[model samples]
Target: MMLQFEGVVATGSAALDSGIGHTALKTLNDVTYLYSVTGPGGGIAVWKLVEGALPQLQDTEYFSGTITFQVGGIGMPATLAGDDQLVLDVRTATGLIGYDLNPDGTVGPLQETGTLTGGGDISALVQFGDILTIAHESTGQIATYTVNGDGTLSLSASIAGQADSMQVLQAGADHFVIAADATTGTISTYNVDQNTGALTVVDNSDALATLGIASPTAVEVVQAYGQSWVVVAGAGSNSLSVMELAGDGRLIPTDHVLDSLHTRFETVQDLAVIESDGHVFVVAGGGDDGVSLFTLTPGGQLVHQDSFADTIHSGLQNVETLSVAHVGDELQILVGAQQDEGLTQLSVSIADLGIVRDGFGTVTGTAQNDMLSGSILETTLMGGAGDDILNAGIGATTMHGGAGADIFVMQYGSDPTTINGFQAGTDRLDLFDYPLLRTPGQLMFIATEQGAQIKFLDEVIVINSSTGGPLTSAEVFGAGFGGPDHIPVDFGDFGGLEPGSSDGVQGTVTVASEAANPGLSDAEIRFTPDGGGTISVRADDEGRFDLGLPSGTFEGELEIIKTYSTASYEITALDALQVLRMSVGLDPTWGPATPENLIAADITRDGMVNALDALAILQIAVGLPTAHEAEWVFLDDDTDLSGITENNVSYETGVDVTVVDNVISTDMTSILLGNLEPV
Candidate 1:
């Protein structure tokens, strides 16, 4: 996603440092603090991170004295000694210095200090567990040291290189250090010894000139799609380069992005990576009087998202450094504005860069607003919640705005896409991409049986409206299309139900079955006329239905189409035993066996409730397939349904019914098959 302009904090007098700006953030007991070091002239400045309507950097403090001449700094919130105290580590031109951060938000006395023997200025500082690494910018020297429990430092190892900016990438148990040398114009990767904290040369890429990266000043690492990536900001060429960090410590340059006229990336100095939602965004600041944002794809591509260049309003005057922090659900970036001499606190908005996917399949979104673009062949986009934007590419596309206001975009060559759950006033059809189709008045809104059809040229977008009504001009956003010719709203054959039709008839059908008082839940009843066609309606849990019939006379037979719950308490082995007694001529007088009870006991539908039916009922109780033909039996209330014995039984699925004056009333008795004592 793109980075939107948020609030900015001025560094004030703290901006006088000559080197590139660097920032670090640490949270202690829910309170966040920002540590900033800008070049050679400044020491270390700390600000209390205040988050509210907008993030504010207030109550600035300084760890002054001999800690000046610093170029970069890092905050170790958890030290190697296992103490949960924050240690502020600053890299000076001469060496490295560490300070204890007091709980009162004050800088304590010097905890430890280390002197570098190599002839070079300290450029960057990064810590991995107990190992701390420092990069020498001028002489290209790298040093590794162990941070002692008592806040003392011991040299672990040293390597020769023009290290300008360094980043440590931890891949499981293996740790690798990447160094960017601005002077030598080279990027180096070194393997770190986990136990001894020593650096071993793996490989180096001296192809900055070949890759158009003149000066690789800043470097940052981010993990996406289970792979690690190193994003380098080249100040010499005003560009950002992405390289895949292979697991074996090899750097493979994949893709790079240069500053364009639309985005200001002039002389990019520092880079910081932060993940918003599930997207990985890289924020860069440089000589340009603005800040730019880019998304790093899993394939190591730098896709430019957005940029803001208003120095007066954004306070991003020659932004030198950036560091990201998560303030609750909000992602805030502390920008070190070198020219403004202040830090700008910017919050990350959920507005993502355009998400483009090719081919087909369904693309679903979350509760947050999302931008989805589908191209090539049939594709389906379903926006579950929030205000979403769905871009219809080519071929057939199905879009559903499950909730919230959504925009359905139609470009040239985009086949007609089906739009579901489209609220007329809330959701709009975006036809801005079409040169001929501009204004809403230019488009034709025709109401059909399938819903509303928004037509322009040969392209058509079908909207599945809840009310099945045509849309208005207010539901479209664009310029003038072929227009001026209005298509009248035609409800046509779907205007509504006609009189005397089954669907037009309003009546209630309640089923009384052998399931206590509120009989047979979730039963589907179908009314088939003697002529042709069928009308169906399902009863609710209370076994009642506001019958659905067509708008015409219905001379038909009503039958139970379907029933629920194959497994019921009535169908059990105990019921099977009762049926067994009746089959053997030993009538257990739970009640006088009626014709309905005898029909229900006929599990095999062979006109007899015998020992075979009892055996089937026992099988049903154990969840096994039974020889029962029907799960339920429904018969008409009035008929020769009496005196049906084991030798004589007859039944029909449907009962006779006729609609007079566009209304029909009928009732049926239901029985769960194989249930002998269903009371």
Candidate 2:
């Protein structure tokens, strides 16, 4: 269907609408649309999708300011390539604003045409095959511009002619036409060369076909009634001029010359064609302020169809240019208001007219890791609608939900959950580490519910305690899985053969006592502290201590001790110190004595049988480490006593008394009885 245009319409914040230049509007092959507009700010307002609901267009990313090339004023429209692109020329005090649009409809840099007055403006947009045509109203000439691959434009050909407004329709590979209506309230048509944009005036052209078309400002037409024609909108009488084309391409009068469509308060500036099907279409718009439709029969006559003009608010707004775009099966009308920054869009869906979509495909829903109860691998998850639960491992990842009732899942750490949020499929949230599970004060406690029981799951080690959910203490839980128990130290040899901590060696010692009491529990005894050599004594069924060390020579006195503690009980009493000493040949450097070396009672060196030697022994033998005592001795055999008178001992009644004299022991060492020696 051909579009019925209402040109560039805008709304919302007035400040945001400031620099939007939306003048280069046109239709191609009559479908797939193209137009350009400036940003309210640095970018333009785009209407896009959220979660597949009805779309809302609001002002968004923007850039350039002000429309300088005069595209919307008494101007014609043009599109380059196919629907590949379109161009809008701006009119400014400095120079005209010229913009090249991408096929996808984005505004690029504006070019200045180098018009010396710095005041030239562009009117009309026309496309003939690969070339795009623009008419400079100031120069009254036609310029055919070429479309480059990178979406830039350069002039290919120029032809001088006073252009009021130009329109081009396909004639041949390189042929086109331009109609320049005059400021003197007249209309003229020219057959154009597409290869050069050169003008050839047609012979049958009537200079002022409609006498009252005072401001023959804009003209539009599409083929009907076996020929191409023109609908010229005028300012003075508000008349519509119907111009017919001769075989050579000149504007001739139709059966009816001038038809008064509407008495206007302003010059009419918009026009359009609406197709009902592929073949039939209605010519409409460009009048005092209403939309009227017309259709042609097989005969060469123009027939009027119904008008939606009554639906329009009479004087509330004025529309200058109109373009229609089909979004799917729906038709949207865009009207550009010249006098005021006014825009109105009216849309209607053809499917709403009793059409059904059977094979119409679908609008897919997103599926992601958005569940509430279980663990999920982020890499395996797809984004979709609905709440979800996720169990995560150690990593950084994204979770998204596309639509209603959506849930996002993330496993926090070994112990907990970290983040939860809701948004569209593209929304992203970051999960930080769950650090609180590491605090020191959190302890594990076992509580048994009334009828509840506590036990290590794997161990079957039962606990008889009260239970609850998992009583505070803020404990993290795991499925019961326990490890091994460790062996402990025993008595006696628990701390084995370690040397005396003081002198670092086995010393002169005395044995106090010895006992072999192994510790309560039989521990696997082992050497103590690795570097020190070892001592080992096994612990009995009842833990006890049994330890001793051999004595050395220097007084060798030491206390051998043992401490015993009952299993799970503390040691309370101890009889631990036992001392032992050795006195036989204790010194390796000294010898035994008879007389000369005897430090005891044998004190006389004369080898005597007399009391004088006994008296010397008595004096010193009574005192030891120092022999200072006088005449008081611990006796040897009590040989001399002052008070004794035959009471201590008695010999026979008849006693023989003999006297012996001692010799020097080396000179004559024999002692003899007289009778026994002579025999």
Candidate 3:
């Protein structure tokens, strides 16, 4: 029993949204997709396109609580891989990263993994053999994460940043993922290491080989003969290039087919290519919305056989994302009609997927300029050469303005609370029109991960501030620094408190004060140095601050009072002996002061210029002393530039600094042993 898209009638549900990232998978086992058309008034809708023909959507109830990133950069959804296993991306929950998603769709806590500066927009995803690689549109970070046996994932490596699209193809044992960068307008190649999931840059400046590939949007690979071929689509140049992939994972451009040459379509973004019955079919749809078929030589060269031209648009509806399949008996082409805000499926018996009707004209909207907000694709609503209103994404969205000095509006949040989260009613509205959307209360900033846009909208008015305009707020804190000194304000949960060796993961850590210090009654938890330090603390009823530093290593302190009478006050630290050997558990302090304080001669882990100070120096060089221990006691002498070898010591070629005395030298070393600062 084969089920296909017979027709699309209406939508289903228009309220709280839920989406499984990337493509929606519909199996043969009766599960259909329904669109829920939405309006401004928060009107509810439930228009079933398939009616009772499809199984109802499963209730995503248990997945409620803190809204954390649900999917990651590896083999996710479990449906994407084996039923017993799933791979997820490194994330930051609380303060930790490396958040894996379970088959039950639950977050697998936090763990530190590899470093990935950018994690947004994983449109280009694939496992180039061993490494699960994804190309990000936000930062062009070509990151690869390895899937662990426990279904967890670790960030392996990421180099290429802000790539438009990616596709993995194999030739012999070597594998490569073709990456088309949106920013550079070039086709880059990556060689993936199967063992470590590492990505090595193959070639990014291969644009010289390509003919008209200006800013590619889609890339697909087909195996013809023993060679693999890459089909690159350009939304900018309105062209498609056919490149050859050698077994070594290098791209060799053989030829290209420009849309201008066919005089059919102007731009191409979404497309699919398949090899069927000894013929290679390339369906180039979306943007101009058309398809093209071709024949390939055994040597990986594309010879265009036939192509469908122009837009067979259903009225003014625009098809943004397109997916084609040569499955079962018929060729299915599913088009995501973006502007139409619906999904249109057309099953062509190898003919309808071709050209149906031409004469698809364009809409020359009002002679006066209109407005547009949110994000824009490669080829999108051209403002018809007028002074149009454009509200590009928070980042610098590519706007042609088409010879018109268009007025663009971009906004983001400046206040700190905005960095955390928006308050109630905080509408993250993407203003369709510039002037109308530029009503002030919006803040715009650069995206830390992806290079796209970021606009922080405070539609909720949730911040605990009393002043400021529409994008301005006092703070998320109540009375104290981060919050009130009395009330227990929420700052969310702690992330991965222990990530052993994962690169990208930075976990959460909370410090609880011991039995209560006697000299710390009026203390206040403040990230000290106040100006920009990361450490903070708040005492118990008796006065003890609990500092929760997300990052593993940090060095900063809080205060005992709301306002310190004296800037410098001695606070008791764990005994230097006990603090140093934190590796071995310390015995309980029965009363006070013990011989542990007088362990041995203070071993300064820094430079001691005096020749007579060799014994103390030997202990430090061999990794002696604790962070809270030891000090140098010496006066006025040139710190020798000496190096100790397996044989002896030779002071030569030293760092540029003047060590007046052992005390100064020791202090300098302590500063070098910097405390963990909040990231």
Best by TM-score: 1
TM-score of each: 0.53, 0.40, 0.40
Please identify model 1 stretches exceeding 4 Å from their true place: 1-8, 11-20, 38-41, 53-95, 114-121, 137-139, 204-210, 350-363, 370-381, 385-679
RMSD of each: 21.3, 47.8, 25.2
Worst 10 residues of 3 by lDDT: 662-671
Better of 1 and 3 by TM-score: 1
**Alpha carbon deviation, residue 306, candidate 2 (Å):** 2.4
Q: In candidate 2, how many Å is residue 547 off?
A: 99
Q: How accurate is candidate 2 locally (lDDT)?
A: 0.34
Tens digits of per-residue lDDT, candidate 2, 1-679, equal: 1123333344454532333334334333332432424432323333321121222443233334465222342222334333333333445424434444443334444554333231345555566665666666667666666655544465666666544556665432324464545564545555666555455666543324323457666666656434465666555544445555544564543322223332222445555544332222233344345444433322212333234442343311444555544456555555444334544454443332211101001212234212222111112233344322222322223222344333222223221222223332322221111112222123234433321122211111112112223222222223221111111111122233322111100111111112222211332222221111122444333322232111221111111222211221211111000000001212112322222112212223232223343343333333222222111111212122233221122111111111112100011011100000110
Relative to the true structure, candidate 1 reaches a TM of 0.53
Per-candidate clash tally: 25, 81, 61
What tens-digit string does per-residue lDDT give for candidate 3 at 327-352?
44455544444444334454444321
Shift in Å, residue 437, candidate 3: 49
Report the Cα lDDT for residue 37, model 3. Answer: 19
lDDT of 1 by residue, 289-389 (tens): 77776655443444455576754666677777788776665667777766665666667655432333333467777666665655444678877776666
